[model samples]
Target: MNNLLLNKRIVISGAARGLGLSFATACAKQGADVVMLDILADEVHSQANLLKKQGLKATAWQIDLADASNIKSTIDNVIAHSAQIDGLINCGALATGVGGKNMMDYDEDLWDRVMQINVKGTWLLSKALVPYLKASSAGKIVNIASDTALWGAPNLMAYTASKGAIISMTRSMARELGEDNICVNCILPGLTIVEATAYVPQQRHDHYVNGRALNRKQYPEDIDGTAVYLLSNLASFVTGQNIPVNGGFVFN
Candidate 1:
């Protein structure tokens, strides 16, 4: 436990039981107060309880990031309680299960749902939190993206498109927030194993694992350390970059 994030306050979205949870726990271990927000009430609360058991400050906020009004209120509450946030990890996203279909087979409604959460949610949440981040001496924003966004996947047209938007937004956010001392970056994770991936076809998972240079499946832990680095002093000079944590799945 190096207190890389000592006394810092971080906000992690979709942090019930996956990559988001991993980041939240790791940040806690590093001495940062963590606010976990997810749609699942019981699960999020359970996670908060676990963190508390470890003697970490944790709060669970039930939120639907897709709703602008709710996101606004949530941000107000978070800032009110924490005073200021040192970092923000926009890990909330909706993919195939929530409307990621092949381009030709994709319905407009399904596409809208994915875009609303994955792209619009990220944009709005970050926009709302900009003021707090700007006020911090070490402000960082890490947007979770997917490698398919870079290479473009066929069946996951909507997910890929939304992620591409996220990547673009990351660069633009970095440029705009730089003068304010806020670092905006995106992490394009490979096919990492998580609750979300349970819906993915087994063959698809196998394909990703076999194709990766590492020839192994990616776990949530693989990306947790990267998240820590991006939010710490170690990455103070880094911004507007899309760093891949996908084990050479889609080298950029």
Candidate 2:
């Protein structure tokens, strides 16, 4: 929480709540000017105001990741406000209430929705911001994936597939952006306690808690330190890696 991120500006998606909110707070604490983007405009604005009241640097913008035009406009406005975008945290996704069905029971609409938001959203947002990231002296990208994808978690096929794709995309993005000195990486967190995972079955939660080597529940905060590290100069040499931050629930 020192001045590691001082003078750095980071844009976090899905910042209205859940894990994204945790990332926003952590980045602010580390002295980064935080740009919070989410479809929940009111909530993100309120959260940014809260950060401001805490004497932290934060801004809010509404962005629908699934909509390309919205993403382009938001990116332009973000640049207009400040041309330098030092980092990006791709945490936005349609996670809440998108589970509880087996792959066979999953409808085409459900699968497409998950892919459009979770997979395509990550791609589109990163695509829109890479130019700014490339322009930075040191640029970093952290794509939030999931342990479910590593373990092939049942009844969550579509959602898991989307996250799996993110992990792969992280590697490809890193290679493409490396020439610009932009480091792209992925984080695979076990099922953490957040608003997005509130609907998860108790049984699944128990499995995560008991299966982990730590033998404890994971929270959004558990993922923050790793995120802060990846976003800072501390990880300047790191890129295209899939880090599993699930307290040893599953090895990647």
Best-performing candidate as measured by TM-score: 2
Cα distance off (Å), candidate 1, residue 168: 0.3
The Cα error of candidate 2 at residue 10, in Å, is: 0.1
Clash count for candidate 1 is 0
Candidate 1 local lDDT, 83-167, one digit each (tens): 7789999999885384335667878887888899999999998888888898899799999999988887768888888999999
TM-score of each: 0.97, 0.98
Residue 83, model 2, lDDT? 89
lDDT of 1: 0.89
Positional deviation of residue 58's Cα in model 2 after best superposition, in angstroms:
0.4
Question: At residue 185, what lDDT does model 2 achieve?
Answer: 90
Model 1 Cα RMSD, 1 decimal: 1.3
Query: What lDDT does each candidate get?
Result: 0.89, 0.94
